[model samples]
Target: AEIGQVDGLLQDFPANNQAFRDANFDIEQLRKDIDQSE
Candidate 1:
């Protein structure tokens, strides 16, 4: 069951990544926010 779940996640990863990029997700800004809180 775990193996099947992993396989599904692997198959979905590219689509998920594309959607994440399409949303203009900003990693640098996130890091900056984290830095400010620290």
Candidate 2:
């Protein structure tokens, strides 16, 4: 996705927000990035 698309998603999707509620994280794209790296 383009930066614009990601930025838009971050703006619209509450789950996509990077704000930390606790020590845990969203882990939404972690698998995707890890797969690509592998």
lDDT of 2 by residue, 1-38 (tens): 99999998877777534344322343646766788999
lDDT of each: 0.88, 0.65
Question: Model 2: how far is 9 from its true place, Å?
Answer: 0.1
Give lDDT tens digits, candidate 1, residues 8-36.
99999999999899666677678789999
Q: Cα deviation of 14 in candidate 1 (Å)?
A: 0.3
The clash numbers for all candidates, in the given order, read 0, 0
- Estimated TM-score for each candidate: 0.58, 0.34
Instruction: Tell me the deviation in Å of residue 30 in model 1.
Output: 16
- Model 1: pairs clashing at backbone N, Cα or C within 3 Å: none
How displaced is residue 12 in candidate 2, in Å? Answer: 0.3
Model 1 per-residue lDDT at 24 = 62
